[model samples]
Target chain A: MSQVIVVTSGKGGVGKTTTTANLGVGLSKLGKKVVLIDTDIGLRNLDVVLGLENRIVYDLVDVVTGVCTPKQAAIKDKRFDGLFLIPAAQTKDKDSVTIEQMQDLCEKLKEDYDFIIIDCPAGIEQGFKNAIAGADKALIVTTPEVSAVRDADRIIGLLEANEIEEHYLIINRIRPDMVRRGDMMNVDDIIDILNIDLIGIVPDDQDIIISTNKGEPAVVNPKSLAGQGYRNITERLNGNNVPLMDLEGNTFLGKLKKLFTKKQ
Target chain B: MLDLSRIFGRKNNSKDAAKDRLKLVLVHDRANVSPEFLQKIKDEIMQVLAKYMDVSDGGLDINLTTATGEDGKSRVPAITANIPIKSIKQK
Candidate 1:
């Protein structure tokens, strides 16, 4: 069965696009057909993340406006099989696509793909509504910051209000060193505050910067910790029971030392 | 009022400060609490406090805030009202 998941974080610059790109790559690596739709119109970046910027002949606006079909607008991933991206328009307004069009587009694509991952824009605006119109589930992305977590809580409420109840959390950009030093919010604190099921915990790895700049997702790099985290997320999202790979334990000072001592 | 710095002392750890703060923030956020909601709460509190003693209406200060318990591990959202007692009333 196909799953339409909307990846959203109400606050901007919290790795929504990055998560969308990598999860698209990660799911496809598991041999599932995946299509990523970028709904952040006029500020499109998914194409650049997937290294398909130069190949976009038609965008999501074109597809939804009936100017082009979904097939013609989707750009296949250069590195992975069964992975495609439908990028947003760079010149159009965020309100260009109606909710009905977005839902219809997802429904049409669901038949041909195993997963339709929609990258939701920042804030609880019409863009967010458009992205989540046909979503079956939601993956809320948040960093270990007060602003991000607060927004995640609000987004969860919005998701529930929209009747998309099967929502999960993905805590991104965690710093184990800071967490061990008692300076950063750990995974448990965020999960406890948000009160949601965590699908993955991505560490703050420098490799993400390197991979992102190269237009290659961190999931493509086996040595990248972020890659492993995304893979674990894909596994758990696929219904595999995987123990969380967070660097800290339930207690602050005890288990965190053991986990990081081995790494250092 | 939530004494944020004390809860974030080295022994308490700074991360807990964030968690506790977020807990209170979400409670207010999720409840859809507004200035008007707090005013309504304060108004009801005033009616109850008036029965026991005379309270200085001008000095009344009420708002929704957080307080860390004695354990310091569990922080909860609370409604605080600072009503100055003007005089005692007896039956």
Candidate 2:
């Protein structure tokens, strides 16, 4: 069965596009046909992040306006097979597409793709509503910051009000060192507030920047800690029981020292 | 041993402060009610209760909380009011 999931963050610059791009590539790498829909309208970055900016012949506005079909607007990934992107138009504003049109587009794409991941724009505006119109589930992405978490909480309430119950959480850009020093919120602290099922926790890594710049998603790069987290998320989405990575686990010597200190 | 540092310490770290602030803000945000309005509601409730009974000035509290219902699914927002009454009026 096909699943239409909307990846959203009410606060901007919380890695919504990066999460969408990486998740699309990660699922496609696992042999699933995935199509990513960028609904950010004017400020389009999913195409740039996926490194498919040069091949965009048509955009979502073209499809919504009936100027072209979804298949024609979708650009196939250069690296991962079965991965495609329907980029948003840079010229048009968010009001260009309505919720009904987005739902219709997703309904048509659901037949061809195994997963339709819609990258929603920031804020609870018409753009956000349009992106989530046809989604069966939602993945709320939030950074470990007060502003992001606050917006995430509001997004969760809005999703619930809209009757989107099959929603989950993904706490992105977690700084374990800062968390250890009580300088940043930990995973448990976020879960305690959001009170949603966690699909993944991506650690803060510089590798994401390099990969995004190269137009390659970090999920395909085995060396990236963030990539591993995304891969684990893909596995969980596929119904596999993969334990979350120990992003903040102490070293063996550190654990032994703690044990000795306790004994003393 | 009474640790002097514990008695006069920098009370909260930034992370804990963030969590505390989020907790308070989300309760109000989720309930679609402001803290000041909650306090107003608490005051009204106490006044209504005091009409038939002697209500205490303190210990009257109202809060928006999240608790799981009987369905075992997820947390639902709840309004809890606790008022301390001294005595009931004799009719």
After superposition, candidate 1 runs with Cα above 4 Å error:
A246-264, B1-9, B47-52, B65-78
Which pairs clash in the backbone of model 1? none
Q: How large is the interface RMSD of candidate 1? A: 8.3
- lDDT per residue for candidate 1 within B1-91, as digits (tens), equals 3433234436667887888788778879977889887888888888988999999989999867767767986556677878899998998
lDDT of 1 by residue, A1-264 (tens): 999999999999999999999999999999999999999999999988888899989999999999999999989886799999999999999889999999899999999999999999999999999999999999999999999999999999999999999999999999877876778988778887888988898988898888888899999799998998998999987879888885655456546344444331
The DockQ scores of all candidates, in the order shown, are 0.39, 0.36
User: Chain B TM-score of all predictions, in order?
Assistant: 0.61, 0.63
DockQ (0 to 1) for model 1: 0.39
Share of real interface contacts recovered by each model?
A: 0.64, 0.64
Question: What is the lDDT for B60 in model 1?
Answer: 97
